[model samples]
Target: MKRLVFLLSALTAMSANAQGSKKIKEKDMPAFTQFTYTGNDRIYNDNPLKEGEFYTPVLQGCYPDPSITRKGNDYYLVNSSFAMVPGVPIFHSTDLVNWKQIGHVLDRPSQLKVEESRISGGIYAPDIKYNPNNDTFYMITTQIAGNMGNIVVKTQDPAKGWSDPVKLQFDGIDPSLFFDTDGKAYLVHNDAPPAGTEQYSGHRVIKMWDYDVKNDRVVPGSDRIIVNGGTDITQKPIWIEGPHLYKKDGRYYLMCAEGGTGDWHSEVIFVSDKPTGPFVPASNNPILTQRYFVKDRANKIDWTGHADLVDTPDGKYYAVFLGVRPNEKLRVNTGRETFMLPVDWSGQFPVFENGLVPLKAKIKMPKGATNQTGKNGFMPNGNFKFTDNFSDAKLDYRWIGMRNWRENFVVKGKNSVRINPLEANIKAKSPISGLFYRQQHATFTAETTLQYLPKSEKDLAGIVCYQSETFNYVLGLTKKGKDYYMVLERTEKGASKVIASEKINPGKSVKLKVAAQGDAYTFSYTADNSAYKNLGGTVSGDILSTDVAGGFTGSLIGLYATSGNDIQP
Candidate 1:
């Protein structure tokens, strides 16, 4: 099996490089730069990315609450695409570490409306920001359901499209975008100002408004409050939320992400002399933390904070934030990656030399990064192998769906992708013709290859492992009334059962397949392509985890369809 996965990835990179933090060695990993083939996506390189090192989820799976912004030598970043529908993802670094997904910011579905919203409820934390004297880029988000709160979108070319959402009446969740130093433009958020009153479970507050980019909105009365309760309102530090806004040397800092995000997530600081803030509280205040390394086994990296900070057009300072790594017993099925380091601003403030634990899976690259064309990082690039194989005609921009918006019902066949199964299934209410992409390796497998021929029983289709709409796992391909099975199904918490089945007969095609490794998921199938069959149990990738499918995205394996339910007993 590929030399037992290369001697079990070189004995787990020689037992994590004999216990120190900077290692990456499965033969200098990065999937060996090119020898062809990188199937189960191995490049978990335990550290070895040398010479000024580098390699850290520069942007890995479930990229959560990140929000970086740069514009000139290029930087971008923008995660937190809640109900997923091209909500807000956009990456494009020039080497503040490597990154490259370059597109997404509500890529239209009327620009801000997640078809009924559910799985972690629609786009919640976005920030982007780039107003080079009005060249414009702004993002600011939080739309748990249509335009009920913060929203603002723009683009001078967010990779070629964007601009439609502008509902910034603000109530808040995690919206940001600050441009002050004479250009004036603020938003910063966390919410609770419709005449204040929240004072408990992280009792909200860190506000600001005044936007109005030539009538784009948010400045009618100018809104207020810029720091309340976070940073010592007597340590009420609960869910103080991700609220970025920086500007050093001229002051006006204010970074957030307090206790609520798991294991008491952190990163807290404030400092104002203007940008509105009688703000102050940064004697290194939480400044950044691994929540006390939870148990500190040399820094365990528990749910660390939601940071932002950026600067590198020959400037240096870098941040990015959001962490999580637990694979088996500590359990986290990937759900929050994106972690970059560097930022010691000579200690006048910003720091991260182990900024209070967990930031060393190898880091360094940032003192005038030459923008390595090493083909957008985390390996497999030089030789390629992330796989799609439905034969492409356009759909390879990292597919996504679930809040529907795959360019008018997804059709692109000649090689395959004719999915028309739209009676809405996955147990309806929101699920529809899914078509995901983002399981970004912890070990991979994901298969597809169905041909379809069921006239009823809602003509289902196959292959999923998704993580929302009540957690998922499905295996699909049904017809019940005419007997054509291959189901497997799961769905936790919100409930749904069926574990295993097999009875197929549509022999023109059928591949299926699953196979994650750390949280388990196994399933298998095959018919026209020969030899495979092995479906039944082992589905617990923590029920599409976020602590059992609660959602912030990550775990969207792929391909789905459904029609079966018009009544035919």
Candidate 2:
């Protein structure tokens, strides 16, 4: 009963930050920080670590649905970029621990048309595999929003660019490419059976097709069902997706994720002698999961699945998969993150039972493993802290926009970035125009000084703590009925509600700030460039989390300017 009372108090405080003191309940009159952080957030490494340990999140932010390849000693990785322009991000590493973003597979506008794509509805999972026989790198993926169903793009040197996409006929999402020791190649994916019937909601079948290298397409009339509705059709293992085929010791192995991507999420495996399987499920399924990680533990790692396996040049096995760290009450704020785990085949089948936490791996450094640092020279971990004066003629490479390009609005000045408000408002579904950076940490303060005081009440320029078009919090200065007011607003499902507002005297500029603590955030502003004052009631970061926003991307902290008056004809 006490816990429930405190929770209600917390909710009251958060709502007050959104709806103002009048809506604030007397039970929560006191301003208190409700959320608690567990502290796994650190973006970069400060010192060189022993070979037994390495920094995680080889690639950070909304880079999900990862695909990896190894060419000789070099390792190449690509993650699904979704609606963001410059689609699939391609990364390179020598040891698979230290990765550098070499380029993006979908760099050309001609290759993909993501105009007005919902944040969640864009590119799906992608598979990056190398064919030594052809000396080429092949990438295949499903377009969630634009283009045809599934497409394959290739490149000889990925650093340069990739060829135009070649459409592949596959009825599924997570498309993967696998080459056999022999000349034969195969493509495996999750799709509804030919009968198009299912026992349960997540009952998707794994289908296989002969991939023709010569024609660069699936062989005509060669679709086969490898595993019928998961390990067993009756038990009905749900969401048996993200299949990766491997051949080892002359046995074909297929590994996949089961249980929808939530608390029940896990990795499972099957083995067969042929490329297409009469496969047998391992007795020990759910090879990787955090469900057993002690729910009440201090460090909580949950939602572990969507994995891709890779073998180092030295024949060592490792896996890169998506995992999440919930902030409070199992509400996730960081979105799904990339985590590394060892493939313990010595056990029954193969599994990483310890779950999502990064382990102290006892492995030799690959031939070309080198430590890479961010622009700030910090080592990589969970928290990525970034600050830019915007003095350069162009925006930093780290900042990304929605459907539009960041270059369109980011103009140069002496020491500041001058942004022209987009004709569209941020509340619109038509991808909002904002220059955003990933909110890598659960708790950090973001502050920006803006010089604009609106000539019209319609000018809205400020710092946005955003998840999607439907979910965001804005703290900026605007004119409310001829009075310059500092307003805090919460936008959910295209509706914007003012939480609090303070009428202030007009100045040359004002500094807006947001401090995140656990799942909650506090917004403040300073017109004098000093003496910050709280602007709104505390707000929940989970509101902007992918779990609430419904997307494959994470939360982004951005500088946005929208002419609320600028509506379409």
Candidate 3:
């Protein structure tokens, strides 16, 4: 009877192993359960489109500073793809809700050096426009930190390919192009005030000058300061930037994103009879914003504006803007995600009544629009669960290393993944052992169990919130002599702030869980896998915009291990 029972148990174990192996394929992974992962929610409902639904981000991994334009019935969108190779990832959509990546605009290395650049310094916001006369597409980006911010690029046919970056001598960032009805092209850009001056030039005025397409330089034309800074209804200084010109109903609408492009700032519109504006704010300024009042709800997420407006083939107008999905639980990976909203015209000005919409499960395409489909190399839904008995030719797409990756980071021990510390300190250069994925949701929980052998006081291992090489947060285990410390390191500036640290008795295995409820996150550790205690809570930094940091990408959550000096596993 005992032998029979043992045989049953062994068979059960084998069955489990086989099932797990089959599910380890990258395609089989589930979507990351972040804010944007609305498993059963519908993208659009029966009601007239609401605020959050239209602009809720479909893709969660760091798509920011969106610039969108319409070509016939098709809508093409591009966002800042900083530091990642093949920058300026272009996406397409028939209905604004369901989006698919078509291709990247900057694919050549000569166009930009993306691999070696820092996270925030590579590319700024890019504007996409279709030349009506020639039916060509143009893209412009600001390469910050490289050439004293004097960088520009253009392409005649972005869908086919992009030309080498035609360097334009510009002083500031956020470069945009305006093609007037008179067959003349103009460049609208922002510039800082003169040296030692407190008043920045671009914030108070939108400078307009002729653009020389052949030479890729701003011509010596009469410069005009169309708009000036002033106090709005809120009586705050209105710093205007991101100027886009549209002529409608024989009136010129000069729309710009305002409020310093942070939380509480918004998309403000102004109108004038002429392209060069002595413009007046729309009676209803700040046409779109997420700043609403609801009791018991925290309005911690800020700066919900910076938009690209497009008109559909049917003459229906829409605006694509950026807003953060604040999870009460703080399990957010979708930071400043893209949202779509219908633009309604009241008399001569534009009005946006719909507020921010939360992400939903599936959204339908616009009528008569064809769906464009493509694979994202990695799984679209970034759920990172896989059983690796380790004998695979390559690591899973879900796994990413810290500074440097090496063969010794993982060891196949029978049918388990054995992770060891590559360096003692988290600050060491290229700690070969770390795995991460883009944070997809604003609210969710991530938990993992780890077994390790600590060899020194500098050894540490656990999960981390990686913004870049400089800014990040770590919640993991650190070793001191024979004891262990559950340490949380917040990296900002050039130093590490240990927010919470708890010592533990020597143990062979530990389970770690990090729960993000909204902007607040809590870390917990358990030795028995039964009851867990909260270590503490921390907030995610405001690092998504072009002001605080310049990049289109968002944050990532992953695993890490560090050895101060010796290699410990």
Q: Of the candidates shown, which would achieve the greatest TM-score relative to the real structure?
A: 2
Worst 10 residues of 1 by lDDT: 28-37
Taking the tens digit of each residue's C-alpha lDDT, what string does model 2 give over 1-569?
66664564455334323321223233211111111122234322233356545555555556677778898878888777677766777777766767766767887766766666887767888889999888899999888766567988998888889998888876788889898877889999998866656777778888899999999999989998888778777887888899999877778889888887887888888999778878999986767877666665544667778888888777777788877666655666667767676666654365663543433312334455554445333225444445576655444555666765544444444366545455566666554556776666666777777776665576667788878878888887777667787778888777778888788874767777788777879998877867989977787776787777776678777777765532111
Please, what is the whole-model Cα lDDT of each candidate in the order they appear? Answer: 0.68, 0.70, 0.57
Candidate 3 residue-wise lDDT, 55-150, digit = tens? 235455567788898777667888876554456778766666556665678665467654335665677777888767557678887866334354
- Of the two candidates 1 and 2, the one with more favorable TM-score, higher being better, is 2
lDDT (tens digit, per residue) of candidate 1 on 1-569 = 66664564455444433322123322211110101112243343433455776666665577788888887888788888777777777877666666677668777667767777886788877888888887888887778786557777787877888877778665667878787868878777887634556666657778788776788777878888877768886766677778887887788788888888877788988777788778887876787777665453532456778888887776668888888766645556667878877887765678766868656666767665643534543222211246555564456566787777665345444355555555666655564766777775556666666766665575666777777766777787777776788878777765777777778785766777788776777888887777878788676788777776665666777677655432222
Residue 35, candidate 2: alpha-carbon lDDT: 14
Cα RMSD of predicted structure 1:
21.1
The C-alpha RMSD in Å for every predicted model, in order, reads 21.1, 11.3, 10.4
Point out where model 2 deviates above 4 Å: 1-51, 346-348, 353-379, 382-384, 392-394, 412-415, 565-569
Ranking by lDDT: 2, 1, 3
